[model samples]
Target chain A: MNIKEYIDTANKKALERMASVQPILIDIELEAKNIIPGMDNKTILHAGPPIEWERMCGPTQGAIAGILVYEGLAADLTEGYEIAASGEIKFDCNHDHDTVGPMTGITSPHQPVFVLEDELTGKKAYCTLNEGRGRVLRFGGWNKEVLDRLNWMKSVLAPTLKKAIKHSDGINIKTIIAESLHMGDEGHNRNRSGSYLFLSELTPHMLDTTNNEIAKEVFLFIKKNADIFHLNLSMPHSKLIADAARDIDYCSLVVAMARNGTDIGIQVSSLGREWFTSPASIVEGLYFPGYSEKDACPDLGDSTISEVIGIGGFAMAASPAIVSFVGGSAREATLRTRRMYEISAGTSSIFTIPSLDFKGTPVGIDIRKVVELDETPLINTGIAHKEAGIGQIGAGLTAAPYDMFKDALKAFGAKYL
Target chain B: MKSNMNDLLSEGPKVINIGLRSFYEASETQGIKVVHIDWKPPAQGDIETIKLLDRLL
Candidate 1:
């Protein structure tokens, strides 16, 4: 085919891929089946950028070990050491299940997750509950406190969320996200507005079912960390939409997000179920007080994938405060978001950008754009310590490596006519 | 006249405020008319003046 034919074919393939793709809900219960609940040495944890054990960051590794001890998967440090060597227990990447874990992102059988389903195409995605604690599972740590907390989430928080969501007749997260962006949230790195919106929508239901005292605590929990609570929704929401654009043989769209506690992996639209991975780059940005890059984990988690589907960093212009968190000027945020247009195939009908005079937010990542411009998508993500249990140490900006897509594209070209 | 000058700059028109003396003299000597009207908002920033000299036509 000539260049014109190629261009037309590529664009059409991308659009068709996006339209046919569906986000499926992979219930956490289903995922948990793979894990033998309670810690055992058999379970091993890994992290971002494909680093060796010696090079592994501290906090993430700590979290991984902590979960093992907590789960009783191993007796103690000595036995856990033996278990690690015995390799009797299973160690796996969250991405293998169409899930992305934050920091340590350790999800075991005992944990319950909100499986976000794509009603259109019957595909599903999974993510663990928002560990009310800052440095919980996603960051890789399990201790008595963490275990107790996870128990509460499974027994109390998850059920309450279910009841509340059911009471509200299903939360239209996309709507809340769009509204929040206008109210100063880019929908990822920062979620103050979205958090409030979520609470407001869920309050009536929460109030109707529970007593004022119980309701108050749950309300406070959501309100206090309204910023991060919405993260759970954003991840599944992005997964839902990205899944919507999946499985068109020749269509090019993004399908998966994985951080092996080492490198980040992404699947492409036309690539057809194959992962295109790149070294997880270190995040660059301002951190919370007393925290520095040294305390931060390399880029880990599936949350950044939300930006890949648009509304994370791509809508940064709408939330200027993120400049402080993700390390860039307000103008740079605007430019960064606008730059995404160079790599995307379309804009989301549900999400809009306020800074660009309210243009539709870019969505549906196109491999052709990546190949043609050599520009990969930019994701704003949180930093966790390499050791497990230390929790979140910071937040920053990281770009998807182009090499992954370039390789995927090569594979795609060779496969198709 | 001074008040009118300020009003012209403030409400009447957006012109460079040549001092009252020069403006008054220019109007007086050049047959230009100066009118004092109700104080309105200043003219917008779009007005410009053009000059053409008749050479050997």
Candidate 2:
């Protein structure tokens, strides 16, 4: 098909996929069952293209090492290396359970994940908690403070949010996402607005339905940890909707993309359960003080699923303020999101873009477009350091490796037509 | 009433974070300098200094 015809057909299919969309919320059990949650981790959490992690920039390595220690599977860095080499710890992706997470893609068993369940199709997706900042465990900072914080999230924060959500019969993420975009959040890198919106929704419920003591404590914690505590919820909510778009026969859509620290993988709607993988790409961009690009990890984890389904950076125009967090300009933000239309299947009904004059954000990824147009999916990602202990260094954009798509196409051609 | 932009511009050369993909044409008259900082290897708070040189009239 010609590109326009191809795009039109793809758009129609994407719309259909979106119409069937639903949100799923779930808590993942990271029992060393060979799965890691989130997109960038699923793609190249290891050491190859679409990303090459062996030459990874440093902070990423530190994060991975920290997660190993956190998991208690390794005594130290040396042992972790042996374990990774031995492949004793299987790196399963959270997308396998329809989940996503932030950098380092570390979702351990004890962690509580907010699963967004799309009530329509009964599909469920998961994402871990957003531990309030400063050398977080997921970014490869596994200090005692990080461990303690993770424990607190499991014991305190998760239960409170769960209670609040249950009281409200679950949160309607689409409404919040749309509102946040207008309030200067792109719903990925800049979730400040979304978090406030979430708190606003949960606050009333927490106050009324919850016991006064629990309500007071939850409110205090959320107020203190307001650097977008709801991001974890947003990621899984996106996953829930994205999962509803998965596995249609003859559909060339992308169902999911997620990663563990060791591998990056993508699942196409047509291909169903198969994963297209490349090594995670090392992030290259501006760095914090005393840190350089050298400290960043190759891209790892499922956060990109938001971008794939449109919202993260793809909705950059909707959140011009994001320019401050990820580094770019207002015009660039507008274009980044607009360009996604070249490869997408359709726009979302629930997640509309305010800056684009209320046009819907692009939704549904098409693998056929990836091949026919030679345009891979673009993802805005957080940059973890390359070394085993350093943690997050920065965030930037990374495209899916082209070879994975080419390979998937070759495989599809052999089987379908 | 005072405007937010008026207050913001008065701060002068503040460090702002943004994604690499968000760049576009910036204004020349405002004396605003835009420096591009990469978000890779995300540091705690990385800031870049932008010095805007006047274009020949």
- Top candidate on lDDT is 1
For model 2, report DockQ: 0.02
- The residue-by-residue lDDT of candidate 2 on A1-417, one tens digit each, is 543354346446656766666553433333323333443221223221122334333444555455565567678766765655454544544556455667655555545666666777766666677876667866766567776776677676677777667768667777787788788877777788778887887888777767788778877766666655767777877776666656555556776776544556777766768888776666555567788765666677677778767888678778877777677788987887877887676777767777788988877776655655445667676676665455667777767766676566555555554
lDDT of each: 0.64, 0.63
Q: Runs in model 2 with CA error above 4 Å?
A: A1-14, A24-88, A208-217, A224-227, A259-263, B1-57
Interface RMSD of each: 27.1, 18.9
Q: For every candidate, what share of the true interface contacts is present?
A: 0.00, 0.00
Q: Cα deviation in Å at residue A154, candidate 2?
A: 1.6
Q: Residue A331 CA error for candidate 2 (Å)?
A: 0.9
TM per prediction: 0.76, 0.75
**Top-TM-score structure, candidate number:** 1
* Model 1 DockQ (Cα-based): 0.01
* DockQ of all predictions against the true structure, Cα-based: 0.01, 0.02
* Model 2: TM-score for chain B: 0.24
